[model samples]
Target chain A: MFAPVILSIKVAAIATIFAFILGVFFAHLLTSRNIPGTSIWETILILPMVLPPSIVGYLLLKVFGKRGPIGAFLLDTFGIQVVFTWIACVIAACVVALPLMYQGAKAAFQSVDETYCLAARTLGSSEWKIFWTVKFPLARPGIISGIVLTFARAIGEFGATLMLAGNIEGKTQTIPTAIYYAVATGKEDEADVLVLIMTLFSFFMIFILNTWLKKKNYKVS
Target chain B: MGMYFKIKKKLAQFQTDVEYSFDKGVLVIQGESGAGKTTVLNCISGLKTPDEGEIRIDDMVLFNEKTNIPVKNRRIGYLFQDYALFPNMTVEKNILYGIKNKPEYRDRAKRKELLDYAGYMMETFRISHLKKRYPANISGGEKQRVALARAIVTRPRLLLLDEPFSALDARTKETVYEEFFSFKASLGIPTILITHDPRESELFADDRIVMKDGKIM
Candidate 1:
């Protein structure tokens, strides 16, 4: 009972961290430089959110499966298996939740005055220092909300996590998976408890996130 | 011998073909809006690339048909028309921001020297009282002073101003311009100022060029 809740929290936390890092990094790159075919790359990065979660899970399995190139290399060289493990759950959540964080960060960065960046450049600051000191600090509010959104999405992930990590009773079961299993086994009372807990957690996360965003006067589109 | 640019660039509606050589003092480029005064400044500062151009400052070729120097290495101080101060930083931090890239930024004594110099500049500009305030909290004149302090703190070889006083009121403008003139004489660096204010041209311009339709009239 508590095991599934703990696992979900752990998986979401790890996935949100990874997603936050990649999202901010990509957001900075996408906003600062004029890359050719920028819209195409942006669309590709955001595809996971638009697509069905099951499809994302399946894609992950294909790449990280034992017979697949990456999975085969890992299995042979490092004696490590990722699929059907807790790591797979984190990976699946990260894939599906990244777009929200990326979009949020990108919008925040876009609203910053390019002239300030140009001024930093003229002031003799390297791109790296300017990003950390100027760009990132100004965009903090939106990025913080993005992180909250990512965690909420990751914790509630069901279809993708199930497909990649499996619904093992003790090892891989998360809150969503446990709720589904409980209902399937005619344990309606247990399913109701899980559903109530998930709903309350999601509501709290959103409530706090919204209040923080409002306090900062950040309009996250 | 000071700063030179022979350049051509095509814009949406106008094509710029300009050639100028400045030896010293403040050179004012007076023009109406859309006359490409800002564009010329951008080109010289390495913020905008021209299709065909050669830029030489103090006998060193900054850009030509074959070479384009990056903005950081150009050592040109540009004061934007809007006074682009970093919104997240205090006035002191903003002024110190550029000096981090200088060679002396790493040396303890040199860093102290730069900081002391920056403090002196802030005092001179009458912005020492506003040092702890963020850009968003400062008045327009204060913001301009902070921006100016940041630009000159790096000790740039060339100073570029895009309507530096356009945002200030008449009284504040008078005071700021007075400070600017005194500061300009002390530094003795070549400066390119773009403004439509005839009074600025009358009082401060050492050599003036009238720009119309992207060319010197």
Candidate 2:
């Protein structure tokens, strides 16, 4: 009864952690440097958010499929498989959730006063120190909200997870996949229960996010 | 012991071409909005790169075509037009921040000495009472003093002020100027101040460079 729910929570938590790390690093990179073709890079990072989930799933499968380059390398090198597994579910969730994390962090970093960074530099602080002490703290509220959004997106992922990891019962069946299965099989009672749980979970996360942002005097316009 | 730079940088509207050197006292760069006064300070502090130039503070080469020292290693203290106080830190923490990451701090005795120095700076700036207060709660003049304290706490080789008194009122400006004069007298380092206000210029400037359309006159 609770296997899918527990699996969804685990996948979302791990995916959110991965997204947060990549998102913060990429956000800092994109904003701090005068890299040529920055806008194109930003657009590429953002593509998964707008692309069809099935397309994202298809791309993931291609990269991680047993016959693909990366997949074949892993198999030959380490005797590991990635496709159609719980790991693939996590990968799918990370891809879909990453854009949210990236966009949020980028905006947060951009909003920080450039002068503070310059001031820190002139005060004999290394670039690494300035980022950890000055930039990160000032941008914390926005970054936290980004993390929450990523977790929400991760747990709610469906189409991509179904394509990549499949709807294997007890193995990779997340909340969304389980709900779909219940509805398609005409198990209306089971579907209703799962829907209630998912809705309540999402509402709780959003509620926490709103409260935190408000406490930090951040108003969403 | 002096600072020298001959820099040329092309802006959207004009090209900056200037050559100057300053020994020990305050040198004021007086100019209008588009005269590239701030850009000069940015170049000296290693915050911005020039198309062609060599910057030397005393015997150290801060910037040249072949070599550019990173901003942190340049050891310049800069007070921005906006103060740029770390909004997340308390006044005391902000003042101490400049020295906290210094290599000297790795030594236990040196760390204690720096902390003592920070306390002295807080007392000197009259921010001892506001030690726990965040920048958002401090007044404009108090913010400036705190910023000044933070800048000079590192014992920098040079000091750069970009209209440091622009935000203060007449009364606050007078008090802040007095505080700055006392601070400057003690440091004995060269100062480059960019300000359009003639009164501010008259108060602290030992020498004045007039800039018009990015050219020194």
Candidate 3:
């Protein structure tokens, strides 16, 4: 039980990192005027956040299963398996958590004054440098909040991990999966303890994030 | 330094047709709201591509019908009406934002010169104490000073100020104007400032261009 809990936390952390990076890129792309089909791409990115997690997990399995095109390529060339592994849990968590990070990052980036960016450009810094130095710094609060939210969401993920990675005890069984296992086997006391821990952890994260956001004057709107 | 701009473009609510040349002096653009002064400045700085135009700064052709340079290559400093300072950055970071990544000069000399200039301007404008404050923590007048400091820090070939004093109090505006002229005299760089105040134009401009309905009137 202890091992699964620790492993779940690690998986959630890694998944949050991946989602946060991709979320920043996607937010920038969505807001940039030069990118074509931005609206369509944004809608697709948000689908995972809105649609049922079970649907998302099923879709992931179809695309990344052992016989699927990408899965087959990975197996033949890289000798790597994706489905029913810890990696699958990470992938599932990232898909579910992407929209939160993207929304937060997009709002943060958009809030930066265009004139500041223009000033950087006029000073001879390239586009990449301007983003890293000026834009990213100004948008730090939003990015930080986004990371926290993504991490919390990934940690609480259940349906997607179950469908994609399965409840392999001490391997892919996360806190939520462990709770589900405990309840199914009529282990009421164990289930209660696990649920209490997960709930407290989530509440603490959210409370801290809210306080930080308020102190930094980060409005949700 | 000198710049020449000839642009013709159509927007949803307005159209622009401007042709002008600027030399090393204060060239003021005066007009009512929505008169396309900002658009003209944007075109000159390569922030907006004109459908038909040519922009030349000194010997370099910044924009022509056949060649369009990006904004980063234009090397033209701009001061927005809102004094768009990064809200999350300290004044030091805001001022150093432009020169932070240049490979040619990464030491403190340029930064020192800029800070010195900012200090002089702050003393001139009485904003010396606000150097460490963030944009959101400062007043409108302080924000304008920081914006001005940031704009002129890089010693741009052409400095464009768009409605710079519109957001300030009268006293702050006067102080900003005084600091501006002193800075202009020191740098000797060509400047094109936008204003709706006839008195401001009369006081500061060597040549005043009146823009009306997107055309130079």
Highest lDDT, which number? 2
lDDT of candidate 2 over A127-212, digit per residue (tens): 89889998998899989989999999999999899988999999999999999999999999999999999999999989988987
lDDT of 1 at A220: 17
Candidate 1 residue pairs in backbone clash: none
Error (Å) of candidate 3 at residue A166 is 1.1
Name the top TM-score candidate. 2
The i-RMS of every model, in angstroms, reads 4.4, 4.5, 4.0
Q: A1-221 in candidate 3: lDDT tens per residue?
A: 68678978999999999999999999987776578888888999889998899999999898899988888889999999999899999999999999999999999889876777876776677888878877887788888989998998999899999999999988899999999899999999988988888889899998998898778762211
Q: What TM-score does the A-chain of candidate 1 achieve?
A: 0.93
DockQ for each model: 0.51, 0.55, 0.51
Report, for every candidate in turn, its global Cα lDDT versus the true structure: 0.88, 0.90, 0.83
Question: Given candidate 1, what's the lDDT at residue A27?
Answer: 89
Which segments of candidate 3 are over 4 A away from where they belong? A218-221, B101-103, B107-128
Candidate 1 lDDT tens digits, B114-215: 889988988888899988987878887788878887888899999999999998989999888887788778878889999998889887899999888889
Docking class of 2: medium
Q: Which TM-score value belongs to model 3?
A: 0.91
